[model samples]
Target: MECTICKMGETKASDITVALQRGELSVLIKNVPAEVCANCGEYYLSDDIADKVLTQAEVSAAKNAEVEILRFRK
Candidate 1:
């Protein structure tokens, strides 16, 4: 795929994490499919996934839930 921003010649699909926010709610998603531009380092997600993220953000906001970011020492 060609990059819309940088007009890059080559792009690849990669797994990425997207941070979504609605009001005071926020969540981090994993293993999202995205087209990343080689030249510009820009990532774009599919429309279906974007819609799903928005819906999930709304639900999360309604529940007033918070996701804790954890780190472990090994």
Candidate 2:
């Protein structure tokens, strides 16, 4: 698929790390499955994966985690 952010790039399946931050919380999740743009290094995650990632982040934020590092679980 072509990348939306970078029209010059094609997106390919890859495992990438996602960093998410909110208010006083920061989360880094690694080994996430996504479509990555070859040119601009943009990434897109599927709805299911996005939901899971957000849920995990929400859990950490609920725990008042200032920073969290986690491995993606299928």
Candidate 3:
């Protein structure tokens, strides 16, 4: 796919983690699909995924949930 931002040749689909913040609320999304530009490294997310992420973030923030970072190695 062509990159909309950089207008590069072809972009690769990759899984990206997005961090969102609103007021005192913060949430991190994992494995979000995006088309990344090979040259400029620009990422684009679909509207559907953006909406889902926002919704999840709002729900989590409403509950005042804690954000934890976990690391696993094999």
Candidate 4:
């Protein structure tokens, strides 16, 4: 698939880290499956993956976490 951010780049399957922030909360999720742009290094997560990541971030925020690091698991 072509990367939306960098139209010249094609995306490949890869594992990457995702950083998400909300107000004072910061979340780092590692080893996530994504489509990564070879040229621009931009990553695109699938709808299911994105939903899971967001859910994790929301859970962390609900716990009043200032920062959280998590490993993605199927």
Candidate 5:
């Protein structure tokens, strides 16, 4: 698919890092599956994966973590 941001490159399956922050909490998830733009480096995650990432971030926020790094399990 064409990238919306760049409007110049097609997206391809790639491994990416998703960084999320909520108030005092910050989470960085590595090795997540995504479709990335070849030109602009924009990444898109499916709704299912996004939900999982949000859940993880919420858990980290609930724990009051200032920063956390996790590997994507799925």
Candidate 6:
């Protein structure tokens, strides 16, 4: 698909790292499936993947994790 953010580039399926901060918790999930803009290096996750990531972050935060790094799990 064509990238809206960068009209010059196309988005392709790629592996990405997702970094999110929920309050004081910092979470990083690696090897996530996403649509990446070849020109701008933007990562766009699907709705299902986004929801899963958020849920993982929530679980980490609820456990009072200050810093968390994990692999993306389907």
The count of backbone overlaps in candidate 6 is: 0
TM-score of 4: 0.94
Ordered from best to worst TM-score, the candidate numbers read: 2, 5, 6, 4, 3, 1
lDDT per residue as tens, model 3, 1-74: 88777675578898877777777666677777777788988888778877776777767777887672211111
Pairs that collide, model 1: none
* Rank ordering of all candidates by lDDT, starting from the highest: 2, 4, 5, 6, 3, 1
What is the lDDT of every predicted structure here?
0.68, 0.94, 0.70, 0.93, 0.91, 0.91
Clashing residue pair totals per candidate (backbone < 3 A): 0, 0, 0, 0, 0, 0
- Return whichever of 1 and 4 wins on TM-score: 4
Native-structure RMSD, model 3: 4.6
Candidate 3 Cα misplacement greater than 4 A, ranges: 66-74
Q: Estimate each model's TM-score.
A: 0.72, 0.95, 0.72, 0.94, 0.95, 0.94
Better structure of 1 and 2 per TM-score: 2
**What tens digits encode model 5's per-residue C-alpha lDDT throughout 1-74?**
99999899999999999999777778999999999999999999999999988888888888889999998878
TM match of model 1 to true structure: 0.72
Quote the positional error of residue 34 for candidate 5 in Å: 0.1
The positional error of residue 57 in candidate 5, measured at the CA in angstroms, is 0.6
lDDT per residue as tens, model 6, 1-74: 88888788899999999999867889999999999999999778999999998999889998999999999999
* After superposition, candidate 6 runs with Cα above 4 Å error: none
Best by TM-score: 2
Clashing pairs in 5: none
